[model samples]
Target chain A: MIEITEVKQYPFIEGKNLTLCAPNKDNLNLYASWDNHPDARKYARNVFPTTAGDLKKYLERGQERAPREIGFEIWHKADCKPIGFIGFNFVNWADRMGNIGLNIGDPSYWKKDLGMEATYLILEYAFNELNLFKITADMYEMNTPSWKICEKVGMKRELTYMKQAYVKGNYVDTYQYCLFKEDWEKQRQKFEFK
Target chain B: MSEEKEEKKELVCIPFIEGENVALAPTNIDHIQLYAKWNNDPRARHYARNMIPHTTEDLKKWFEPRGGLTEHVGFEIWHKKDKVPIGTCGFGRINWIDRNANIYMNIGEPEYWNKNLGTEASHLLIDYGFKELNFFKIYAGVFEPNIRSWSVAEKDGFILEGIEEKAIYVDGKYVGARRYRLFKEDWLNRKAKK
Candidate 1:
């Protein structure tokens, strides 16, 4: 077993209830356990079982990142635990645009508005710190929590692709949501970030 | 279209997958003015989501090469007989992991409207996507009133999948947007028969 207290803490973006920190590589087993759960894995498109070795490889690949894709663990301030994760993917620094993927692994933490908090925290980091112009999100049609979180974060429905992804032995539509820096500036207040 | 620029365009040595009347040419950054004209034209932009005027700098950033899953690429539709650039057609936002992409195209000059250039360009793009890119499915979005767009998609063997109501704010009011898809199996079948 990996040492928990020995794991280095990299606190980066902090929100009212959630803190976005660097992904802890030492906790690959913990992350894999969450990912292997069917409820959470469904939205993430994990048809195959995810092992800790796979996660270790993923962390190794992410370690060579040029800020193109950044992953973060969502630390709940009240619980003082990493209940979920969020990240930027396929980021084009020149274009100042990217797509984001996020998940709250613990089902017990569902519908708590912590995902919304994490989103605002990440948006601030993406638009203001990274100087990105836009951030997009994609979710299968049946994953209401994901697209709903996108809507709650003031993201506009960019496109609805018909039968774009296969999930649970069925073809499903995919929903794309986009939030521009300018639009975020205007709608940021709605998120009620304090 | 200046005399010097026209001469340059004529002498330009951008190779293409040549067709009978139209060739899919590279989108050279030097011809930003040509692309900007198409992007800014109300007739063309009417059906597109591009609301802002495009500049050379934006085009340069857009032409930057991107790899992996979420890349956007466009091809210039070069009219061989007229020896002029007619339009642009190519993949918009691509989900490479899912093996699907959005096929977007437009004929720049209004004069080329009824010449079947759009249909020809669509066919070329669809073929390139299925054969070259190995995409499993390709799709296009058409506004509610744009029957011409839907017809072109049909001619290229696309089927209407679904429609999103009030999906777009076109001229004044919100409008429904139609979605169309062409599967690789169907495309390959057509090619084999031909």
Candidate 2:
């Protein structure tokens, strides 16, 4: 069994103007609010509207898991406001791999390259602290904007299955992308973390 | 303005077979070392279908047959402005069956990996494939781990065919392979779209 722990405190991972940190109950409302956004629901697995109570229960369950996947709330370090969430899920220790998912729930932050910065920080934690060998991510083929983030951050598209999953009564293809530890190291060197 | 005009020269149409910026010409004995370095690079090897390290002798033997092909061709990918050979891109494994061939390239110099040189060279090669070689289709195989290659293929308008599982073994693991093809008809369509 893989032991999971909350990163209770973290130094601000500054990249451009964005910072990332572990989510607390105070930010649970932000998660709830983002969960209710229509655009967020379009690609999210659990599309149903979420409340603060639901988020609390979700985080609690996450904490109870053997291989605890942590979610971190993204912030603008300069302004100290919640922007979105970025973290790992479905972590498998034996394989030393995990799924990385992120969303900039705030439209104000979209297309500002904040997603790339937030992802770079989370990947640093996954590769450096967690010692994960590979990290995988997925997005619907039509979600070009999200996949562009994958491209900008050096994640490679590994697979695209036709009619792989049914979403909202329509069968849609999802592009599976991945970044290995070595590749991540190369990207780390290129990422401007200031 | 007159001073700037004095520095400019007419662009020369160099032979496609003479690769520009590369260190060793395609048929040179030293090319074995070049191939070894490219295959050993984690990023390059990832898309190379998990190629194992090749001894100098192994590389020599591999190139022996390829170098003998009447159409055995290679070109150095140069920095357009500086004209430094950062990589090599060209055809290998020319098969007459179905009138197709494999396209290969290596930006052994890591600094140029994300730059658009590979794409530009590939476009030039595809044009050569159609107008010069008179080929019906051109194909290439990339490992599932190499996402940059897929993006390049997509940008080049190559159609994804299918996956070949456990097709390659390297570093004690079986890596899956992806096949992509660009047909003459599709190429024409793409050209029209452009």
Candidate 3:
């Protein structure tokens, strides 16, 4: 729970509805709350309790791998508060490829198409600014919202692994979606129209 | 006197993986000077793409414990017959959550070049990634001009995944990089056939 008075933003990629900002260390408490919140924790697979200490270490590790990994805090412009996270989990510079990850931890913000807009913004940054040739995202089969956002952002289902993850007492399938720069360029028009 | 001094220097290699030609040992901090030399070697650094000088202090940071699951795991390549270190190789840019890692190798000793040690080392490292680390995919990137490394990847059952045109700046000009990948299932099938 970041104190509302202490909420500060550092916009790295601005979107129509949201801004992908540099991850704020001060928001660790809020991140931990999301990890424990029932609505947000299930899809994120935070079965185990997460403490602010854990998130602080994660943020530090993310910074240590800055060259190969980039992370962002998704900020809601109207609310002036953090809503989610989106960034490349890892980038292969030699191959110009990266794996993206996104989580709208605030359930109140779900179903608003904020995720899709954030995806489009990150895709544009990944291809144009990062000069990445390919971007990939993966999710559990149960995580429909996440994959749907990936699909809407021009990623195509590339691979499916049967029973890849155990969730809620049963194994579930996992899917990988990929978008090449050339393919995304063709599909960018549709997002631009939005 | 030089030979006596060299003999007096303690060998601190702990073999982590053994092969027919060479053994992979946990990178020794005492060998930081050796690692630094390899990074600055003319022939090795050409393919290694180390334009800036790397001091022993810079190399020592790599050997320090970073307190959690490490994204990069480097190993010293030791010649079995000669009982001396020849080069370095291992996994880097590991995506543990996705179970994928990038495999890289550099035979620092120019005298050790032309031998099939790279091929042997790649096989051992890839096996470690797939079997021990439970990695789903292993990747290798080779510069367009480094045909030897390309052949090594080809011989190690890695498939040509893609090529990034002019992706890396090397030797004062840009060059393409060939991305190679091997899946754990495919590797297991090959092992079964063998």
Candidate 4:
């Protein structure tokens, strides 16, 4: 006799080919690997390697939500693996606002619309489920893909922290973008993707 | 007996600098509610980066024991005519190393806005920054959406430094930020000319 069991796919919030779920212990190695990758590190602010021990601590931090913070793992529906990360490191529940941070660990997933889709999914979750008022994302000026993805997903540029970040070798400016729930609602309608 | 107590309350609200309509006073614990109320007001909070909703308790953490937490001392603005607190303004912080600081201001009462109180208070703060604290450089980062704010900074002789593109999120939009700086030498020269 043969037994058959269906494979389970976990997705807290569903997007087309992307699903956002909580970071899992099983994917700790992937997080560490991505944070340490040379190509990935160039875009990411993490100068130090995310070792297994450090990642375990980081995973634990995700569990503690307070005045407001949420973490997510970007799961590729087709590949069934978390190819990226996204989170609100600064969440003001009372103010209905948060500052979002994201990174795609797998370089191959870059420019595949995965980041854009994940952002749309999170924006929906942030405003509808969480009842947030506004969401913001800030990136180094050199991180063109980041700001572009944010702009494509309805975030409008709002602020420039001049020479704020020390990146690679010299000081670089950081661009900040944001969208309100109502604005996102209007903008999301204009974006239809496969 | 009640009248005497009321008089004492009025006495405590006295201003440090008596402007034409508004006067500046060192912020006191009793003024926490006023600060919290204004900060909670979306219109004023939007420009000041007071995104998080502030409760009286939160205000206490910031305004109370104002002596210890930081060098970012605040002042209460009292409307001379109404004898009521109109807003708060002061140095955001002092960089002892750099001999400079950022200017802070907020007109909680929407009615009080554009009444030239900001300009008057800015003049006062700039005087304090240059003459009192001996700061070499006093600067402010005005959000691009806030034209009136930058205009006042300009009127006070704060030169346009450099713009950081997309620096802050407010009113459902990402707004660029302009840095304005005023050197003590310029202020001294202007004073000498006068």
DockQ of each: 0.13, 0.01, 0.10, 0.10
**Docking quality tier of model 4:** incorrect
Residue A106 in candidate 3, Cα distance off native in Å: 2.3
Clashes of each: 0, 6, 1, 10
lDDT of 4 at B83: 79
Instruction: For candidate 3, write residues A35-65 as lDDT tens digits.
Output: 7888888877676799989989888874453
Preferred candidate (lDDT higher): 2 or 3: 3
Local accuracy of candidate 1 as per-residue lDDT tens digits, A1-194: 12256545578887888888888887787788778887888789776798999988878874544567788988877767788789987786544677898888888899988888888888888888888777888899988988888888888886777779867667688887888788889878776765
lDDT of model 3, residue A12: 87
Give every collision pair in model 2. Answer: A156-B147, A157-B147, B19-B75, B19-B76, B20-B76, B21-B85
Calculate candidate 3's fnat. Answer: 0.04
Better of 1 and 2 by TM-score: 1
Model 3, position A169, has a per-residue lDDT of 71
Task: Give the winner by lDDT.
Answer: 3
Task: Write down the worst ten-residue block by lDDT for model 2 chain A.
Answer: A1-10
Best by DockQ: 1
Please write out the lDDT profile of model 3 over residues B46-120, one tens digit for every residue: 988686799998887786669878899889999988877889998998877666788999999999988998888
| DockQ of candidate 4 (2 decimals) | 0.10
Which tens-of-lDDT digit does each residue in B92-184 have in candidate 4? Answer: 767653466788788898988888988988888788778888887777988888888898888878888767554566777656679887778
lDDT of 3 at B91: 90
Cα lDDT for residue A3, candidate 4: 16
Give residue B80's lDDT in candidate 2 (0 to 100).
Answer: 52
The list of candidate 2 runs beyond 4 A from truth reads: A1-14, A62-68, B1-194
lDDT per residue (tens digit) for residues B1-194 in model 2? 87434433321224334333322223344444555666677866655543456577775664555333355467656555554445667777564433567887777678887877677778878888887887777777887777787779878998786675444455667566787878787898879987
lDDT (10s digit) by residue, model 4, range A1-194 = 11113333467887789888877777677778888888888767776667878978876764444546677888888876778888897886645678898889889899887888888888887888888877888889999999998988878777665555566667576787888788887767776643
